[model samples]
Target: MDLVITILVLLLVVALSGAVVRILPIRLPLPLLQIATGALLARPFGLHVEFDPGLFFLLFIPPLLFADGWRIPKRELFLLRGPILALAVGLVFFTIVGVGYFVHWLIPTVPLAVAFALAAVLSPTDAVAVTSITGHATIPPRLMHVLSGEALLNDASGLVALQFAVAAELTGHFSLTTAAGDFALTALGGVAAGVFVSAAFGVVRRRLVRWSSEVDPASQVSLLLLMPFAAYLLAEHFGVSGILAAVAAGMTVNFTDVSKGGYVATRVQSVAVWSMVEFTFNGLIFVLLGMQLPGIVGNAKLDLAQAGGGELWYLAAYVAAITLALIVLRFVWVWLSLRFVLMRALHRGEQRPKVGTRLMWTAALAGVRGAITLAGVLSIPLMKAEDVPFPTRDLMIFLATGVILATLLIGAIGLPLSAKKLKLPGEDPRVKEERMARALSAEAALRGIAEEQKRVEETRDEKAIALASRVAARVVGDYQQRLEAAGEEGDVPEKARAEAGTERIMRLAALRAERRELFDLRRSHRINDETLRALIRELDLAEASLTGLHAE
Candidate 1:
């Protein structure tokens, strides 16, 4: 417990290190370095960080997965559904079976069940690690969408697969038809649990918001944060997929009526809180990977007598094989699946962008291993129920960790550079033009109001107009500064400022007032629930108008 606290403190420090590293011009693969630092600390000085396996699962995976699923742009995900499904579901099965066969052939001493266990452990792609790379890469939005979407959905599917594989291994009963049935049932359970639980909570929250005007912000935030965990726990307790349940719940709230008027505050708070959780959890997992090493080495009877040359050689070879297979398998799956989907879309006269071979290659290279692999590897049963050894657990953890390191380092360096080389074009100019027009128009309105304020002087009748004018100037000035920054960076053309009009600012101001009221209602418990909810809906539309007005 003491060590755990120490490691957590260290993780916080290292997470800060990661953030600092990001601001540097030099390109360093952050996860690779973090993990390497972990490995070195473990292997040499014996700084170990161990976490409760069940607690680790409960603490980290759900929220991370939920965030990814909820934030994925719905339209893009739906459009690329075919290819994404093929890569996520189809290729996960392929990787598991293909790697299972390869492992069995390479290590004949390992049981077929153990080989399958290894395969399941290796199946899921790490969305967060991939995002961390692509997040910095400035890749084409479409490609990022596809990669992120695939990674997110595939994780849920892969975890379900892992559970089934583990159950099969434990029971010594592996049946294909049963596996398929279980998969369907598990997925349905997750969706059902998420919908039922979140809807109930949403209803409760709505009622509470109506009556609890003085509820502490902390308590409100806590309730929202706990929603995912409660859903996950209940789902898992019922033998469903907890991760999927959390993802579903997050998607439901974020996509549906979760926001009252305090969405901006909610969003701001969520990001700040989740960002910290993500960093600490991620840092600790990687560090724990290192901490677990000594125990793994002790159990494996691995020797550093030859400067660990032989063990390193074997581990590297295995990691290389798995890494190569994951990359190649994705390409094969995506290219074939996309060919079919694109042909279908073309036949239907859908305006689909051409997915060239190059983009497929980029996606293939972007599948870096991270938290999912770590979680699965760490969760491996070291001993069967009979107190007999669960075969190959140590070797498997080492191999999984090796793959994580190799792919993360290589992928981080390569994917971003590869994405840049793809030279995907920028956003459509007409959209940019419309945005600039709105921005300039809003600016002109502010100028007009400022002029009116100066003309009105201190007359009693003009006081409200003068106040209104001042607010307009502040809001428009804020937006104009943003536009000018964009223009300075060559994101928007300088000529866009000249083409806009000024008639929309008063409407925007009116909308802002309503939005402010809605936010207040959201924070207030004494408000009439029905009235607040209805007002929030109107505020959302008004906010959209304000966004357009500023962009002009």
Candidate 2:
């Protein structure tokens, strides 16, 4: 009961924090604010929550990665492949090697393997942090794609490296060749598993859609939600990278309406359901992070003081040094790589443009770490072989926490300032592309209506045909207006758009009134719950369409 109550309270806090952040005059990053709120609620309030490392990985990561893969702009991802790979794979290994040595040299008490383990923990940037910061910001699509793609793939690489390092520590040995071979096999195997799982699920979903009369949207949504966990667990069971498996599963599922009759309700309901889950899960993770601070700090203090009174200062200095190194190294690598490696390849035939210094800085500042890093560090076993406490475990947690805070601070302050200073492209080309696509779709819809009108005319019943043609003409007129409004040429007038928006609101109010009447009827026993639900679903779909059309 206490545990359940604690979870409810934490969720309430998450909800309230989201509302509060939105109403603030100066918009702050949501994840950072949640972290601060969690920290505050931990002490004085005496809110204590324990999160198991294994459960944390299982419950939180798969869905987050899956959603990222599902939503990532595939076209942009392909175009930015070179830089994404350079950062995701190349920079990750570089950090593990470079920072691993740096940490080992700084703290002689910590083993080289443990140092590498810490590096691996910090290597992958957090996708949640990147999206939270850049979601509203006017950044280039290519840059956002690179950051997102890197976050998705690097989780697998970083975790694999961490596993090898831990294995080396336990055995008191290390092998470069074996580790490299295992890493390649794990990545490839994970991708294959994910593809297989996704394809299987895709067939099932399509079959269910074909049998729509026997299945409801709720059941379909429930099944869709299980996909990520299934892929992750299956890959893990096969001794492969679960993170990559989840990501690939998300990417492989065909969410678009390519089939003759796509599952509209399923798609719509699944998006809403997943979005809510993502919000709650992400919020809880950051809040849990704050709750862990008191214990982490206490452990670090005791461990460092036991080493020597002066060693506390050394620990602090190391944290600062590592945090600074992460920032500096990322900037240098991005700048140098883009100018030399990527540019040369692009000149040969790649479609990407040469990355400039401004974009490089943007990417560097965007390298913020969050929940994943904390989870990795905290997952370090408390005891290793012979029941001895894991070497530097406390210190590693402390350092990881410090790095997370440092990067968040840097990102929150630097991202906006750099974006402003650089005058990075504020306009998203995708917005224009979406508008054009909608216009084309509306034109096609009009043509379909015209064909229906022609068919009705062939019935040759004057009265019935006249009524049908009038309705068709009205629908065609609406589509024609929408098609003209979303013209491909020049910008629409702000006043006209605002008026159209106002008109939409008026129409929505009328729909809502109708919905209220239907609910009232159900409450009064004039209609059954089943019928009410069916009618409500229609209203929900209408509202969803209106909301989507207006979303920019």
Candidate number with greatest TM-score: 2
Tell me, by lDDT, which candidate is best: 2
Task: Provide the lowest-lDDT 10-residue window in model 2.
Answer: 254-263
- How many backbone collisions does model 1 have? 12
C-alpha RMSD (angstroms) for model 1: 9.3
Root-mean-square deviation per candidate:
9.3, 3.3
Q: What overall lDDT goes with each candidate model? A: 0.72, 0.80
lDDT of 2 at 156: 69
- Candidate 2 wrong stretches, greater than 4 Å: 24-26, 134-136, 207-212, 255-262, 306-315, 341-355, 424-427, 490-499, 512-540, 550-552
lDDT of 1: 0.72
What's the lDDT for candidate 2? 0.80
Q: Count the backbone clashes (under 3 Å) in each candidate.
A: 12, 0
Clashes of 2: 0
Model 1, span 481-533: residue lDDT tens: 54563453353434434333333556667777877877687678657778787
